[model samples]
Target chain A: MQDIYEDILRLAAGKIRQRIRAGDYASHTAGLGKGKLQANIAVMPERYALDFMRFCQRNPKPCPLVGVSDSGNPNMFTLGQDVDIRTDVPSYFLYEHGTFSREIHDITTLWQSDFVAFALGCSFTFEHALMRAGFSLWHIENDKTVPMFRSNIETVAAGPFSGPMVVSMRAINKSRIQEVIAISRKFPLAHGAPVHWGDPSEIGIKNIDTPDWGDASPVTDDQVPVFWACGVTPQVAIEQARLPICITHKPGYMLITDVDDDAEIPVIAHSNS
Target chain B: MQDIYEDILRLAAGKIRQRIRAGDYASHTAGLGKGKLQANIAVMPERYALDFMRFCQRNPKPCPLVGVSDSGNPNMFTLGQDVDIRTDVPSYFLYEHGTFSREIHDITTLWQSDFVAFALGCSFTFEHALMRAGFSLWHIENDKTVPMFRSNIETVAAGPFSGPMVVSMRAINKSRIQEVIAISRKFPLAHGAPVHWGDPSEIGIKNIDTPDWGDASPVTDDQVPVFWACGVTPQVAIEQARLPICITHKPGYMLITDVDDDAEIPVIAHSNS
Candidate 1:
């Protein structure tokens, strides 16, 4: 049964990639690529690569770097054998001088010799872990995007990269908060544990209903709003930096990788050797 | 008696700072300013501040940044109201193009308008915590420096900064390992928890008895050699980066701060507001 499940996952990923490559699927990837690691993609010129890498390093919770492609390389060999950055994602957003330029299906025409692509870990992996642990996520069940807010937290500044941390919220029962923390803490790549819980006002969120991004889910009286560092944080930083040109995956349209969702994403500290 | 203890701490820090400022005390800071936080200081030109900040952010376990001074500011008001980066530390080491230049008592004359000072958390705070928790550290008991080695562990590289992680070792009884972890994990600024334990060979330490830096501590049959991320890791990276001029506190001559030794060093993730 396990072998059959693995086969099904491979076929799903392959078929999804094909559809995305052929410009047939161009939408958010929230529920697709189940049991696989999905990544938020950021593409920029080689000149900003070093600083951007530093930015991601300093802000690992929001921008957990999964794989970084070498200059001009669209193939993320580390992420997968045949992963192509330009077309594997369902949608892409282009930003010029920190301003939104346009949304496109593919960036093959814009790919440059000096371009570098960064694949950051998304919250989907931990969300899967939470589900496996018998915790229900309202956003997924209700078919709504996870609500994200710009928090008052300031990220450690890197060169031309500094902004308020963005967080995604999920309403979890107060009793199961400890269980959620224990499960999510294991996936450091997926933003680790909740950064804030209980009080939205503490993190500068004035209204829980009105999210800066994504649709809000109902927060019951028994539930406390739990927040995790959002992958959109790097996007906020990039916009604040106002680089000449930057590209990112459109919201929810992530690049699904060959990595298993349950695989332990190695923390940076232990990988020094 | 409690008020008197606090008074003594204030007097002790002031006297030590005065002696160091006047060049009366020019040596390692070990065993000095007990119960107060001591910081490892790094000073560099503002040009490299952003990159260096990113480097510290990326490799946080090794370079747990406690405080960062504004550009051209020698006064680290965040660490201490009267803290002056130029002369408060007992001794200073100057490096040029990654080469050691000279050990000096003061850097007032060499201070540049573009210079930014960064104060990193040191292991001393955790060591004190360990000792208070009734764990006997062999190096401290024997009045020897803590054993530090270059590990196979690679720090997340940022800009021109990248090197093998340096770790400080303490021999702790196998039975007390959990207690040590619980105590040390509380001090994130002080390189929290052991990165590796038991086998030195696992982290590529060729000779446990001969550390790359500091004196070797004896590992008894019942005790395991527990390693924690060392502040020296940043010095190694700075050497590799080969910046024009980088300044750091001399070994053991840390800058004692006003922060309480046992106070919680807040994690960056929850501090958005």
Candidate 2:
């Protein structure tokens, strides 16, 4: 299983990033890296950074900001050593006037001097933790993308960023729903816990058989569909704002960072250590 | 005990803020309010708000942002209903050109047209949780202020905000230290768990009895001196920035908010409920 590749995965983060950088790898980064922090990327001009940050702060579940690049700086130094926002992520989706443009492999030519890159926590980190604990996930098992839906939960707006919260759903066996919730709770940066369970209509999803994004996997009689705040929620808001220009990671293709998602902030100073 | 005043305290949030606003309560807000979130206040011109926010984002443990006002707006709408930043805080400390200017009861007259208010989570919330769980904090038991010291732990800087982190010391019993850690870890907003334990020298504190701020509560032989990131850290950074004008809460006087300290984001939407 995945454990057999554990050592490979550990050694893969930087190498895979290099491969992606060289145009050797340009697909979904679902299982890439050292099984550490992989982020959902959003790049925008400096002028909108503050309001966007406020929106993320207010609606943390949908947009848990894990790291941010300083204005006009492409390197996310705080996130990881030598992690460049311009080329690290495998794919990028361009947005102009809040509308999706063509997806591209690299954006070195379009880089703006004042652009700020924001890295929000992705569910992949928690999913990794959950699988490590011996739980099976539907998407990983079937080799399909996880189904995501636009929910009715209204996000608290800040300036021009506002929209319905997007959620990713997983159908878990009824017997393991509680354990799943408990496991996910430990990773707050990774969406924390399910916003709702038991009913899809509870959050205004008209049909569980269909998802707005990704392939659908209907809940069996013995499983409960659990939902988590999706990183795509921010993309939805950012898209709606119709900013003159913005760039986001093509969903499922993320920036792999050197920092471990499981690592909490250092309690002891490195100087003291 | 605080329990004796629980009922009265349950109804005291708005009334206390009203008194503080009307110039009736000019004392510390350590034990006031409905026992929810209490925040450290920082007010500065809008030009500095983005950078200050970056500072908070980069250094979350010591500067965990709980709420922020709209640019130039005094009302902290997201934190609490009718919580005005201008006069709700009991005491205000002014800083001009990186120097302490004066301490005043209110800043109603000094409120700037483009000022932004930031509310960082205070340690009081977690302290409240620990005390409610039957743990005795040395400072609470002795009616002295918690001893705080500037430590060797340097904060990740953003723009002009940079300094050594300030830590509050509590002499927790060696036996209960683990329990204290568990309890405090639940309050990430409230500085979370101890940054250091055992020896103060490990964090470059040569004198435990001589705190840089507040009263001294030296560790006993059977107890361990536990240190947590202090909210005063941001104040220190803001002061060192040499801003022409800025306002902060006096050492122990905090802004009480209606949001519960332990309240996680709603697992289900209110509209769904």
Where does model 2 exceed 4 Å of error? Answer: A1-12, A266-273, B1-10, B265-273
True contacts kept of each: 0.03, 0.13
Chain A: TM-score in each model: 0.92, 0.92
lDDT of 2 by residue, A1-273 (tens): 455344335555777777677876677777777557888999999999989988888887888888777788887777766677888888999999999988999988889999988989899989998889887888889999899999988988888999999999998899998999888887777888888998899899999988999989868899999999999899999999999999999999998877676756411123110
Q: Flag clash pairs in model 1.
A: A152-B272, A152-B273, A153-B272, A153-B273, A272-B153, A272-B154, A273-B152, A273-B153, A273-B154, B29-B252
Model 2 achieves a DockQ score of 0.36
Over B123-172, each residue of candidate 1 has an lDDT whose tens digit, in order, gives 98888888878888888888788889999988876668899999999998
lDDT of 1: 0.81
Candidate 2 local Cα displacement, residue B87, angstroms: 2.2
lDDT for B235 (candidate 1) = 97
Docking class of 1: incorrect
What's the lDDT for residue A153 in model 1?
87
- DockQ of every candidate structure: 0.13, 0.36
